[model samples]
Target chain A: MESAIDTHLTACPRTISRRVPDAYQPPFPMFVGRADETLHQVTMAYLGVQYRDGGQRTAALAAVAEIVGTFDIADGPAHNDITRHTDKEGYVNLIVVGYWRDPAAFCRWLRSPDVNGWWDSPERLSGELGYFREIVSPRAEQFETLYAFTDNLPGVGAVMDDISGEINEHAYWGSMRERFPLSQTDWMESSGELVVVTGNPADGGRVVVQGHDNIALIRSGQDWREAGPEERALYLEEIQPTLQAGMDFLRDNGETVGCYSNRLVQNIDLDGNLLDETYNIGHWRSLEKLERWAESHPTHLRIFTTFFKVVADLDKLRLYHEVSVSDGANQIFEYLNCHPSTGMMRDAKVMASR
Target chain B: MESAIDTHLTACPRTISRRVPDAYQPPFPMFVGRADETLHQVTMAYLGVQYRDGGQRTAALAAVAEIVGTFDIADGPAHNDITRHTDKEGYVNLIVVGYWRDPAAFCRWLRSPDVNGWWDSPERLSGELGYFREIVSPRAEQFETLYAFTDNLPGVGAVMDDISGEINEHAYWGSMRERFPLSQTDWMESSGELVVVTGNPADGGRVVVQGHDNIALIRSGQDWREAGPEERALYLEEIQPTLQAGMDFLRDNGETVGCYSNRLVQNIDLDGNLLDETYNIGHWRSLEKLERWAESHPTHLRIFTTFFKVVADLDKLRLYHEVSVSDGANQIFEYLNCHPSTGMMRDAKVMASR
Candidate 1:
């Protein structure tokens, strides 16, 4: 029996030549995996188009919907979920991420003739309407899991629910499926010791945990270059205790499924000037673990108390947290899987463990 | 006696310190125009933030409501005429391009302390929660009219009518102007001639009928290196004959209020890639004049026929139109304007005309 992929190809013969060389060829094989079992990291970027005339509003909207739809249809059975982001402003952005059982599944969808046909459609063409433009980049990085806890193995929805709940309230959650799927790869840079765990198999979804240890260093300041060495040292010293406390809390908390204590030294764009600095990013198995550490853990509580006090007088600080769900993958191609921004960062933390 | 400006300065002392540097200052002044002759432009850029999360559905619907509000605001003070255009998709491309009389009065309500307080409120800062980054660029361009029709001018009702008609059929245009007395600017550019009509009575709300020959050539795109000589020639040839025909039609038809012809061009991305290259943009004074030209005149008929043929085989094309009342100024500022993808092109067209 012919598969849906085969049928789609037969129905829509590829009529347009590839704008990029070897466009018809799959960029890479697709990888599918069970929710808790698959460990993948993804990244993505988005661009939006605005038009000059209000009358073309419908046409512009149609064009965008069609483009996204094309990608969704091409990903095939391996496709897991996709989410679009837009502000009532004339802007549209979408995120596609997920896990697939194998790489070939993704490749079939990416190289299928139906995907090509959608882009070549004259009715939904971008050039004729001159209303919108978009670019999507998806890539996968391999990750090593330290621990995972789930009642029924692991599925996309469970991971997504955990991640989404950890982050701020967002409106586009359930519909992410049917859009894209997740995949894995071996390409990545080993930076620090990281650990990952997924837990809570009975009542709720599993928790995937990753931890990193003995990282670089970081300090917070309104402008780092302008700071004296003493100030920078003091800032670092002030925050170190808090981080240590957090680590200790993680060690003690039963709900804690994952913990990471690593340093991220990155550049800061301060009014056009580039400043180098470092900060800590970590993940826990659940909000309960994070809250327990924050509220009751002695070391963690003390560190945060001091850090907050110091930054209270300062204009800017480096510390930030991103809670996210594994919404799946956004497949720009087979080798690439674009994860949501917050979730991608967390996945990065997992990669650091290896 | 102190004016309201003085009272405002005294009341909102924080505006001085929070004001961004001059370089970051908006290119145009901010003020509410009176109902009879007010022009306002609100430009928003949603590239970065809107795409960050699952934002597409919420953002798109919100944009539709926002455009509708702008049209509703214009309906006040018996300003019953309006016009707008959207791209092939539902993204709002442009709104508000006509005429009004009492911009000062309109401004009074727009800048009321109640509204100002909401924007200034600590809990609800204007930019904090929205998907699109916004730049409210308002300007007062000067125009002297030489023609007049009935005192009927562009307003919210007219905008609502058009929007309702479009929405009923397409679902995109239906809610553009449900609220009243709001305004925004849309900027776009075209590789066409500059036609400026000046030196008429600036006081009347209606179009002036006398200054037909007072056209000015501000700048031409023919000198640009990126545009080739053949393309330039083609552009000029295409527009000149149509312009002449329009002029003749205005001269012959007693019902003609005013006439102007413009050529719309594609927008370019930050990396300088041309986007949306298929749409053709032209401006007309009134729908009646356009209809008459299309119906009886040979030159206009031929020009339009050629245009249709050129776009016939294309997959899809979006043609947008807006009729607005102007306060003799390009109400929206281009540089500080947000929706840069399309707004930049619109600005280019205005500069070419200048």
Candidate 2:
């Protein structure tokens, strides 16, 4: 009952009229897109680790590979990237991300009865490393994905079962949260403005965030291919400064954006090797506050205007950004370890009775 | 209606009263003592920060003081401490912890007409600071508190409103979750064992966690009075090594005790000055696994037996410990500023979308 072309689509991040690789058994058929409209929930999972030892890194990598190798349910697809770095006083980490088109399939896989027993069992983790896993099931429009430059899908986009055919749409078709189907709160209109731009933080202040109604933005971009000198200069002279200034503003003046926490991370592979891809994760008390920082904050406006020019003029880079707006409730953070930067900890009610 | 003996509980870290503070005011008379025996909900709040600049820190500190000053009610009490610390990778943090014996009163204050007008206003946060506030309203037995040696209640104890009069009990009178009213999953009988003698980790291996149902133990103790040379030696030679080994074991080998994360924290003041108090926090898959490590893990058993001996023989040390147990469902974490040592963020679902 199935078309032969569907065979090639199995385990493929992208499905064009292209030939398929001879040998690729995905950890799971994460997103075969065989489901109908009855599906309402989709879940994504990310598991990552940073090996502390040069030798253990290999063992840990192999352990992850083994787990993936044994994983046969591709109700979705996954992405592997070299990310994260740290120092002596801190730590470095590597991460693996998985996406599922249907929440039921994810639940089925998670509760796969007896399958993937190692994962559900405590034995999957070894004493020699640090690891983390995140799971989220977002309803329609609750989560969105976009890709540019290449014809291929990556990260969460790959795991989407396209019964909805939404993946092929242009990445820039919508603005912020409106890019998805629902979440119409402020989609028709935008809020926030840039206040001022001074010198670098060590010299003077740059941007500030105020208000509790906030929005958080996360973005990752890297040179997909070789860039011309103009592209290089554009990034160096324009992009880098904006990013650094925004980050400095957050660190030096945490309250300016109603920003609670901000982190800029360098990506890494299982080998503990660094990559060009980076992620900026931050929490603002509200969307209006964050928009104000981006719109009027001289520092952010400059970056956005300049960066838009790059997007208009260039094709050598692939970029993606996501915005998740929260009213500050309906979310919980557990502190396995507490520190100066623990999330939502100021609001924590119970301490782990150790 | 007021008692003549009512007096102010000053900056005293430890105050035993034949009396209560006079000038002190809490945001609410959170524990009105009128709630029925059926009433079980209890809440606690902690607000903490790390000042960046001398000026900003001063301003931020002043802002907090003003807020607390205007609170003007205390059916239940609260404790304010200058406790927190920082490092090169971490910014300084100042914390104030409060307890509420009655959730209704706290809610009434939070929702009171013009009662807490200043707190609800978004404009209150100027965006030039780093601040966090945690609000927890756990059901009865969902939370518990204890005190020993010290005269005045601290942290969660201060806000209890004293109807139960449990704060005056010995710190070690109850086991695990039973310290409170109703959490009795496995409390009547104890689990785990304590063995003697151990190799030191510095030379080689000492203790390790190997089971899945283990429970984690966290405690902090500081000498109330000056410790003699013998006391120092007991800490340095006997206690310190064992505690360090247990922590190192968890950090270096995450799964050994069915443990995922463990942190040893030293307390500091508002100015980022150090205090003798400290805290240990950890996450374990189950209580059985944590118990195995505590009773039999070479590193912990040695430390425990010796530490217990000290508890029996000495009164110079004021000690306390707490542990919280959870499943993947009830807990969620958001990563803002990331480091290698951040929480088990692999399970993190939402990163800020910019």
DockQ of 1: 0.00
- List, for all models, the DockQ compared with the true complex: 0.00, 0.01
Model 2 TM-score (2 dp) = 0.35
Where in model 2 is the C-alpha error above 4 Å? A1-39, A50-56, A59-82, A87-89, A113-128, A144-150, A160-174, A185-217, A226-229, A244-263, A267-270, A282-289, A296-299, A325-354, B1-354
Docking class of 2: incorrect
What tens digits encode model 2's per-residue C-alpha lDDT throughout A1-354?
222122322323321111111221111111112223454545545454545546666766665565355345544344434445442225444445455666667667666644346544454333555444434455544444444443344445454445223232221111233333333222312234211121121221111112122234343354433556777666667687777787667644656545555556666554546665565555554443454445334455455545544665665555555444422221222222122223232222222341
* lDDT tens digits, residue span A1-354, model 1: 111111111223332211111111211111122223242332221212223344644554554454445545644433222333221223332323333444455456546777545433553322424221111222221211100121211222222212211111111111011012211111111123323333221211222333232121111112234446655665557765456455544433323333322222223221212243433333333222333234333454355445434543442333332222222232121101111122212332333343
- The interface RMSD values of the models, given in order, are 30.6, 32.1
- TM-score, chain A only, candidate 2, equals 0.59
